[model samples]
Target: MNPNDHRAALADIQVTAQDVKFSTIVCFLAWTFAVYDFVLFANLLPVIAQDLGWTAAQTTGINTWVTIGTALVAFFVGPLVVDRMGRKSGIVIAVTGAALASGLTFVAGWMVGALGVLGLVLLILIRSLAGLGYAEQSINATYLNEMFSHVDRKNGGGASRGFIYSLVQSGWPVGSVIAAASIAILQPLGGWELCFIVGVFPAFIMMALGKKLKESPQFRARQLVTQWRSQGHTAEAEQLAREYHIGEETGVSPLKAAFSGESLRPTLTLSAAMLMNWLGILAFAFQGTLVLTSGKQVNFNDALTILIISNATGFLGYLFHGWLGDRIGRRNTIALGWFLAAFAFAGMLWAPNGSYGLVVALYSVGLFFLIGPYSALLFFNAESFPVETRATAGSFINALGQVGAILGGVLFTIHLSGLTQESAAELISSTWINAALIWGTVPILLSAALMLLARDVRPGRQS
Candidate 1:
């Protein structure tokens, strides 16, 4: 405990590259399946609707309800479970549940053409279950946070996590590619049933691989969750005590205790950050595909291709942004991202017809900024909240963000159709106009303002 001993201990402190790499890979894989399952539902909606006897309205309704379900359930219940059950159990159970739900989707698809209300009901239920699993984003964020150390937590917070999340986020594009390719390959052989049946394979792999996955070390350290310590593995518990400053006496409900009057600044800041984060998610999910859909004579393949490109580009930007956030500051990086996204959205509104090159460029730039903040905010939120409410705050913030997502879908539907424009060119213009209004100017400005008012919570900085 003397200065010499402390200095010596600091000199010997080391975290191997191998450890970081292995941890990152595991997290990436976990997130990849999580993203795949979440996005797969939307990616194959066209096939699902056709094979399941859904009208346009009905299909849209299904998506709306799923968002609503995610917003409602994930916001409150998801955090409670994650906080109470611990990140390891939350992820494992969520993955297993999603796998089972996907299996059911395959079964429902088998009854296609002659599908009944029963089949439709089952599919909807399964989709809702998958939405529940989507709540794993919070758990995954906690897992990644726990895997790294104090130094790693500060420098590698978003940098490492962004890369992992980028890979996981890539699941959307990959799932779309897989869905499109599978439908093309299997449509002739076994019809849409083949696509759904094939879909179950990935979930199966994810579930099995997840079996080997260990609980996050930090999760074991938290004072609120006791199961990790109850297993009698004191090495991890003791290590956590030394590293994270957590001990058995301190782990209580984070939400209940972390948000006292004294902690209002962090509470409000995280709430705003999470709110905007979910809004971005909504915009990406609905607007990304919609932009291409509004493209003249654009096919599903082309739409999916554009999405893949956007996601790929965004992934790279995430890494760049993570570095920026760690080096510069989370608030500055996030604000810069929002501003860039806003600018890109504005350009998209004014671009000429069939200007696919310019369109993609602007959209890509916007997405770059969007993901920089999105990727980094996980750590920002985690660091801002106390250990007791860490998971709870994430759950609440993310759950509330789902409301923004629901609005994004509804806004797109309303404005795009209600524009009173006949030509596809005009429709595209109007859609961008509406998107600019919703996602571009206003949201960015609001987020930037919020960031300005918020307190920074990066670790190592005393409040």
Candidate 2:
């Protein structure tokens, strides 16, 4: 074997158990906090709207703007920033910014009486600013993959990676549950503003945890090789390159590398899948609003109860899909998830009005299917590119997904306008249900079909 191959083999023996533990905890919490801040506004929008005298259209418009902000950051800014700054620094800044923005919501709420329309505008601006922090999620995914390289490739691939990623992605439901619980507790105490206030705490926790994080070794090694080469220490660079089995230095920009030739196909395919997934999530975002405003008009406590239950069930789905992805492979698992989610959403739409049990059951199952396979999907996206361009590619796909979120928000707002208090209950229920079918079920099925074209990147497997 060549010296490089031997060195690569030896380097693999250097990973320690502590490294895995720290990487997993730090990445998972950072992701969880990022998602928590991202979704916190959605959960509390109704109360905020009422306080600000904003209409449904205005509310959805604000959310759409947030989606747009997320896309812009994830696609245009994140790739460049993360690639240049390193993942650890990028995530810390993003998370800190998002947390501070979330805290600003309370200030916006307080200004409503004085600023009126300006307060609403400020709220929208802050929330959209918070959305920029979502770039951390895509960046961190790449970090985790590199950090867990050894374990991720063990047992035919995806054993450790799948479990860790699923756990990390479960941060979505966990964040949602925290949102629900916070609203449940805080809303009654000091009203909606308190919910935003409570949401800010997770950021501090994440920042503290983030301080303990080490830069990804892969990133460090790559930088070292680049530095050596630039300093004309070609021999040293070559020595390090063999130890890491690093590929030839590509002259192309990361963006060009991500979409060039063969890579373009799977890149587009995963982007399509993510777009549909976000569309469904945007529709699902209305569940709280629908339950509160439609068919029998349940109280805030009841609506939150339903949401908590549904999100709790979503946690199980994440675990299931993580396990299933290892067995069936990422593409198959994601396809199955989308298909099952479509049926579950359909059942939710078809359920009788005022049937809380049935609605909750269907909602829970639908959410499970919609959310469970995300970790595996993300893993697949990360694996689609080389280490050099992975973050950019994943973030680019995420940016496309945000476009779907914007569309879903717009569609949801338009549909919600038809469900005024003067409207008949059946009409109100059916209008939102039909919107859910269109926004949730249709795209999900399309995503499933698109999954057929995606290449599975599981270790030891070829598509």
Candidate 3:
């Protein structure tokens, strides 16, 4: 074997256990806080409007603008920023900015009583600003994948990644629960402003963590490449490896040239799969729990209760998918998840009225598949790209996922508006059930087909 390979083999032997634990905790908590902030907007929108005197159209408009603003910014600028700044710094920017924007949005809404159109404009401004920060979720996932080793990635791929991911991912449900409960509790006393006010706190805490987290080791390795070039070195394979603290130079391009050619096949495939997966999630987020439980006669608490259960169940599913992904492979786990989710969603369509139990079962199972396999999203993207442009690749793919989120919102509003008063309840159920079935099946089929194209960069192995 060449000296370059010898060095790489040696470096692998020295990786420590402590590095794994420390990096995981730092990465996971940062993600949890960010997701919590994002989920709060969806959960609390109704309460925000009820207290603020906005029309339903206005409220929907606000969300639409925010989603569009974030998507546009993420798709265009996100890759550049992430690739330039690297993961840790990019996450800090996303979390800190998002937190400030969220807080400012509350302030803007408060001013609406006095500022009139100006106040409403300010609310839009702040919400849109928050959207920019929320867009960071895509970048941070790349950071998480870069920090761990390959075996750790494959073995603990689901467990280590899943458990922490589930906890953070659970933030969606937790945020929903918090929003639902807080709005109900505070509406009589402080009004909707209280919900926005409380939502700001998590962002503050996230800002604190963002301050101290380390850059991923993979990032450090990349930094060495620049160092070698600047130092008047020849960029010899072995020399580059030694400079980067890598055992062997591996003769790999840090900017990931491999993903540009035929490798683009897998890239496009996974992107499509992830796009559908996220679109389904967006669909679920936009309507699932709320539509299933809504009616003039329905109790708000009952609706909230169902959401809590759905989110809680989703948390467990994230863990299960993670473990399964490590043992069985990401594609198989995701495909099976989609199949189960489709059946459950279909059940909701056919189940009898007053059958809240059955509705809950159907929705919960759908949520499980919706949230679970996707937990490996960051890992999957990390492996797909070469280390050089890992952040860019992940960021772009994630931005596409955000695009799906925007579509979900639009689809939900269109469907909900089309429902007439005479057949509203049945229409609601049938629409949601149908929507869920559609989202559950098509995306997974696309995802499974794409899986056949994967390079299986299951960590430790050389591509």
lDDT of 1: 0.59
Better of 2 and 3 by lDDT: 2
lDDT of each: 0.59, 0.74, 0.60
| Best prediction by lDDT | 2
Model 2, position 370, has a per-residue lDDT of: 89
RMSD (CA, angstroms), candidate 3: 5.3
lDDT of 1 by residue, 1-463 (tens): 2547434433433345455565456555555555555666676665566556564335555676777776776665445677776666676666665556567766766654455766566666666766555666666666656555443554654344444544544443444445545556665687555555654555566556566555554554454124335766556446646666554544445565556643467667666755665555555544455454543234555666666666667667767766666667767777778877777766765676577777677767776677656666666666566555667777776665666666655655554444432445655555555664575356665776677676765532321
Report the candidate with higher TM-score, 2 versus 3: 2
Q: Which portions of model 1 miss their true places by more than 4 Å? A: 1-21, 46-59, 76-78, 109-121, 150-193, 223-243, 247-253, 261-264, 295-297, 416-436, 439-441, 459-463
lDDT of 1 at 190: 73
Tens digits of per-residue lDDT, candidate 3, 1-463, equal 3558546644643334465566456555555555545665666665566656654335555666667766666654355566667676777667666667667766776797898778777766666655545556556556656655543543564335544544444544554555556656765677656556665665566667666666665665555555545554445434645533444344544335435754476567676766766666655554443445442223455666777788778778877876776666665676678767756666665677577788778778888876766665556666566566667666667667766666666655555555543545655556655554565445545555555566554522221
Assess the local accuracy of residue 158 in candidate 2 as a C-alpha lDDT between 0 and 100: 40
Better-scoring candidate (TM-score), 1 or 3: 3
Highest TM-score against the true fold, candidate:
2
What's the ranking of the predictions by lDDT, best on top?
Answer: 2, 3, 1
Q: Between which residue pairs do clashes occur in model 1?
A: 223-251, 224-251, 254-388, 254-389, 255-389
